[model samples]
Target: MNISPTDFASLLCSRLCHDLLSPVGALNNGLELLADENDPAMRARCLELLADSAKASANKLKFFRLAFGAAGGFGDMVDTREARTAIGGLFGDGHRVELGWMVEEETLPKGAVKVLLNLALIAGDALVRGGRLDIGAETIDGHVEIVVRGEGPRIVLDDELRGALGGTAGDTITPRAAAAHLARALVTENGGSLQISPPDAPALMFGAVFNAA
Candidate 1:
C-alpha cells in the first residue's frame, strides 16, 4: 500500500497509545484512590496496584523502544539479549505467556531485530487464552532467518493482521495491524520473504528471512 511515512508513524503512535492507556489510566486511578483512602490496608492495596501499573507501563515502553523506535543505540546491529529482556518484560507478568528464546546469534541487524520483535508481538497477541511463545533466529548462508510460534488452546490471528503481513491490507490499515504492516515493509525493503502458517492450523507460526547485515 502507498502510505506516507508520516501517516505510518501516526498509526504506530496510535497503537502505542491504545496499548498503554489501560495501565497508565490505572496508575492515575490508583493514585487518586490512595489519596482518598485513609485506611492503611486500602492505601497499601492502592500502592500495590500502582506498582503493577508502573511496571506494565515500563515494560511496554521498553518493548516498543526496540520494536518500534530507534533503540539499542546508534548501531546497525543490536544485542539479542536486549530483545529477550523486552519480550520477557512484556509477557512475564502473571505468567500470561511462556517465552522460549532460541536465538543463538549474539546480535542481529537492526532491521532484522525489529522484524523479529514485531512478529513475536503479533504471535504473542494471538494467544488470547495465554500460551507458549517461542522465538528463534539465526544467520545461515548470508541470510538471517527468524521464526515466531504461538501455541495455545485458542489462537486468533485476525484477517487484518494476515492481510497486513501479506501486504494485501489495501488502503485502510488500522492501528492494531500497524506492526504487521511495518514488518512486511521491512522484509520487502530488504528483498526478503515472509510466511504465515495456515489460519486453521493447530498452531500459529510466522517466518521471515532477510540478508544478514
Candidate 2:
C-alpha cells in the first residue's frame, strides 16, 4: 500500500517490459526469418510479418508512454485526441476490438489523462475474447470523472486487478496489476475515488473521479 516512488517506478517498468516482450520478440524472430528465408513468396510473407510485429511494438510503446510515462512534454494538460489515438492504435489494428471514445473536451489534465489511459488499458485487457471497449471522460463542477467499459461474450477481470483498482490490494501488488494500482493511486492522490465492477458481472467497468484542482 505504501510503495516508495522508486519501487512503484520499477513495478511500472516491469509491466511495460512484460507487455512489450511478445511483440518485440516477434519482431526479432521475423527479422531472423527474413534474413534466412530464400523462397521469394515466403520471403515476402516474412517481410509482412516483420512489418506487423514492428507496428505492434511501436503501438504498445506509444500507449505505454502516455499511460505510464510523461509523454505530453511539460504541459499540465494533454490533448484528448492523443489519448484516443493511442487507445485506438493499440487495439484497433487487428479489428478484433472496437473502440468508442466519448470524451468531448479537447484536453484534460495530465493526471486525469494518465488515470483514463491506465483504466482503459485494464478494461481492454479484461476483454479476453476481444470485445468492445468504451472510454469516456468529462469535467463537471470542478471534478474530472472517467469511465471505462469492456463488454463481450466473456470478460475476465482478475481479482487482484479488481482489488488494485479499488485501492484494496494492500501489499500484494504485482507487475500485472501495476496499471490498476497506478490508476487507483492517481485518483486517491487527487482526492477522488476509483471503482470497479464485480468480477462476476456481465460486463467489466471502471470508474474514477478526481478533483480537477
Candidate 3:
C-alpha cells in the first residue's frame, strides 16, 4: 500500500533476487552433480543441463537488454526481417507453434522490435497447446502495424492478461501478469499501443502499433 522509497527499493531488490534464485540454484545443483558423478555420460548430461540453463539466462538477458536497457541504438527505424528472425529464434519451438513471418518492405520506430518480441513471447505463452503463429508487419499512415496470430485448441483471454497488455497491474496480478504488464508499460512508454483480438472461431491474435518519426 504505502511504501517509502527505501522500502520500495528493498522490495524491488528482493523480487529480483527471488526471481534469479531458481536458475542460479539449478546451476549450482548441476555443478554439484557433475562433481559427484564418476561416469562420463552422467557428467555430460549435467553439462547439458548447465548449458541449457545458461542459454536461457542469456536469452532472457538479451531480450531485456533491448526491451528495457537502451534505446536509439538501432535507429529511428528497425528492420522487420531481422526483428522477426531474432524474436522467433528466442521463442520458437518448431513443433508447437510454427513461427511464420510476412515482413515485406516494412520498418518501424526504433523501439518497435522490443514491442514485437514482447508480443511474440506473450503469444507463445498463450499457445501452450501447440498452434501456428503468423507474424506480419506493415507501415500505414506513418504508423507501424504489427500482428501475431495463433491457431490452436482454444483461446484463453482473461481480463488480467488484457490489462497486462494495457501496461497496468491490478492488486491480484500474478507473476506472469507482472511480466506482461512490464512489457506493455515498456512498449507504451516508447509510444506504442498493444491490442489482443481473440477470434470468434479458434484463433488468437495480438499485436501492437507505434508511430514512426
- What is the overall TM-score of model 2 with all chains considered together? 0.96
Candidate 3 residues lying further than 4 Å off, grouped into runs, are 1-23, 71-75, 93-95, 105-107, 154-157, 166-175, 182-193, 199-201
Candidate 1 colliding pairs, count = 0
* Model 1 spans > 4 angstroms off: 73-75
Over 60-168, each residue of candidate 1 has an lDDT whose tens digit, in order, gives: 9999999999986665799999999999999876858999999999989999999999999999999999999999999999898999999998999999999999887
lDDT values for all models: 0.93, 0.88, 0.65
Number of clashes in model 2? Answer: 0
By TM-score, highest first, what's the ranking? 1, 2, 3
Ordered by lDDT, highest first, the candidates read 1, 2, 3
lDDT of 2 at 201: 81
Q: Higher-lDDT candidate among 1 and 2? A: 1
Question: What lDDT does candidate 3 reach at residue 155?
Answer: 54
Best by TM-score: 1
Per-residue lDDT tens digits for candidate 3, residues 1-213, read: 122546444543454455457667888999999989999999999999998777655655555455444544746666566566555555654446678887786566656666666677667667777777787777788777778787777556566777767644455455445445555654566577887674364677777777655
Q: Which candidate ranks first by lDDT, i.e. highest? A: 1
lDDT, residue 190, candidate 3: 57
